[model samples]
Target: MFQSILSNLAIILLGHLLMSTLITYRERFSKHLLYIYTVVLFSTVSITMLYLPISFGDYRLDLSLIPLIFLALFRGWKITVPVLFIVSAWHFFMGSDETLSSIVFVLILPTIFTLLLYERKIPTNINLKILFIITACWIISDLPIILFIPNGMEIFKNTFLLRYISFLSVASIYCAFILIGYKNDRLKQRLEFLASHDPLTNLLNRNKFIEIVEVKMKESDTNHYIALLDIDHFKQLNDTHGHLTGDSVLKEISSIFNKYESDNLKVARYGGEEFIIYLKTVYDKQAVRTLEHIQNEIRTTPFHSNNGGSLHVTVSIGLAKFESGSRLYDVIHQADNHLYSAKNENRDQLVVSFD
Candidate 1:
């Protein structure tokens, strides 16, 4: 019996590891692919539990509810509902009528009930809640057994200690996996944040900005335009006021850009003193008007310096509207050329080309 428990535990731990890995990369796959993988995983764990049981007289106990509960708690009803049907149906079809009915009812019915508990209140004190729910579900599942089996109450009273131990063992494994899944989620979030945002300004960095724009260009049905804006005399500002002031100016401009940003517009810090914006505007007049608004906003805003002084700045914008079959680099180059035209013509002007 001890060896059988150990073997079952080993299988459950392996399943948990796979599940943790999948949770880490859950956003990487399509919903349909993830659904298939989750169903397959739960089915394997269920079959292993069904086949391998700790036997006492005519009764066989398997720790199958552990993973089933985990499925509902973490993956939710979208995946868990289908998994419940598959695992329960498989057990009901394959084993002896008495054994399978007992297993299926005990495993499936109580797990669904526990899912209701979880859905209503996702407690902050999760570990204690897990133990409580699993124990409660186990006892609740056995109510039918107590009523139906011959001398059922007496049998339950005798085997209460064994049942507690089995449930505790499974609950411990579930707790471990839950912790691992949360840790992986936190780590993935941190990684994604660092990958997509600029450390200095908290704006989308150049690479991520370009990647998003290219994706939008591919997916968009409407016309989009890319505009590059450069701060006038930024190097001179850094030389005169120091890099600290330059950093402050960048942060100030990023805040303004973010304030004016909308669903149809994206603002990114392209590089030093250069910002990139993408607008989902089909008409040249709309794009020009939006750029003009931003240009005026920056021109009028004052940047406060550390030495109780105020600095005024102007920006030069170069805009290029995307054409059919035009690549991102090509559009950007056109914008860059127009930017130089604005800089050459005057430091505080806008140069745009719809052609």
Candidate 2:
């Protein structure tokens, strides 16, 4: 009995490890690839249960249902549906007389309930709620073994209690470990986001934007255009309306910048009231058109002030083109020069230069 318990514990540990591995690779996998991994995981757990189950008088217990239940709760139908097919096929091939019954009572019913429960908006304490639901479903699934199988009541009274205890013990420990892992993963992602993004505007910060621009310049064989944009008379606006208004205006501008962001276009907050844009393409005309669009949008939009008034502002833009082998500093310097020219010549329009 002790050896049986240890083996089952080992299986649970192995399942947990496999789940952790899958979580790490999830970002790299598409929906189909993730489904394939889920199928493999389900197959392994099923095989482990069939070959090395804890024996009772007329029933066997294994942690095979652990992965199935957890994945169904956490991953939704995209993963759970495939796993259900694989496990059902395996059970059918095993030739157990109870195969049909198990499919309905054991797997199908619980999965249906789990899916239904998962769609509801969980208000709070989500992890605790899920754990409770899983435990309830697990105990509910074990009812047939306790009531219907020959001498099941006697067997459960004598031994299945121990099996239940073992199962819950392993589950509690493993779920706690996974909870910690979830917390760590969330924290890591939060830190990465904070590092690259402005907290106020949620736009790319200067350092990360420059880093990306440098890499793109080095790798792309085509021409790239860098534009420097400055909000005209920003300090005067801030002085007139206060810094709160200044912040609101900046956020509004950032939203407009973000609206145009795409694979070939990147926008970032260069500094206070200033932004930098990187546009990648072979045609300078396309880049100029995009710049014109951005300028027109900003020029027409009136920033709403906190004191119930519309404040109109305009921006000066300087555009410069760079190709492979051009220095990043030189490109930016030229753009800055053009931006200064725009500000000096006229406050509301763009200045573009190629050669």
Candidate 3:
């Protein structure tokens, strides 16, 4: 019994290691990973069925609990139920009538219950509910064998109770590891996002924006436009109202920028009251039209503050097209110069320094 338990545990650990490695590799080769996992799991189930068998008195046990539990937790019920049925049918064909009947009851009923639990989306803390249901099924399935044993109560105490306790402990530990891994992955993703994004407007921050622009500049043809836009008299707005109102104005304008974004364009919050738009397309006229539309949108939209007051805001936009083999900073400097010119000249219009 101890050897059987150890063998089952070793098989489970080996399968887990293989699955973890495959899942890690799948992150790099996302297209074929699911196919690989399906094949591996199916093969594992087949091989395990051929090798392991449990014994109690004159009754034999189908040592399929590990695979059934794995399928229940990972693949859920849809695939598990069919797999359980197939394995039970195979056991029946192998001429273990008593074991086959017990296996059928154990595998099929627990799987159905598992499916219902999953459908209900029960809390993860309800492992005891799962344990109770599985224990109930196992007890009912093993009752005939228990009654036939020489010392039935002693056999139940030594075998079924001990095995069930061990299974419960191991299963709970397995679930804990899975939950921890998921939480760790989530934390890593959030940290990566926070590193590359601005907290204020939830836009790409200045540093990431520059890195993206540099990469794009290397691949850019001679016609892509880079525009720098600044909110006019933004400091005065913050001074007149509060910083809270200024934040509302920034968020309002950020929403306007989001509306104008497209696959060919990238938008970033360059700094306080300043934003950048990188347009990849060669149409300078369309770029001008788009910027004009954004300016018009901001001009017409009355930004409401938390204090039940509304304020109007305008932006000065400067557009410069990248010439072939031009430095990115030089193009940005020219755009900035044009933006200052717009602030000096029209305060609410776009100035183009198309090359």
By lDDT, the best candidate is 1
Query: For model 1, which pairs clash?
Result: none
Q: Which segments of candidate 3 are over 4 A away from where they belong?
A: 13-27, 33-166, 218-223, 259-262
lDDT computed for candidate 1: 0.83
RMSD score of candidate 2 (Å): 3.4
Write model 1 residue lDDT over 30-129, tens digit each, in one string: 9889879979998899778877887767776777777888777765777788877887877777867575656646777777776776553446787787
TM-score of 2: 0.84
What C-alpha RMSD separates each model from the true structure?
4.7, 3.4, 5.3
Best by TM-score: 2
Model 1 weakest 10-residue run by lDDT? 114-123
**Candidate 2 on 66-159: residue-level lDDT in tens?**
6676667666787788787777777778847877877766667777677766643333687777667666767766777766778777766787
Tens-digit lDDT track of model 3 for 1-355: 5565556556655666666666555667665656656555754654474465445555445445545654665567666766766666665676544555555555666566556555334365655765665566556556655665578677777677555655555555555555565566568779988999888887889888888888777664445788999999999988888899999898888888888777677889988999988888767788888888888999999998668988888899999888877787888899999998999996997899853
- The candidate with the higher TM-score, 1 or 2, is 2
lDDT of each: 0.83, 0.79, 0.71
TM-score result, candidate 3: 0.71
TM-scores for the candidates: 0.75, 0.84, 0.71
In candidate 3, which residue pairs get closer than 3 Å at backbone N, Cα or C atoms, i.e. clash?
none
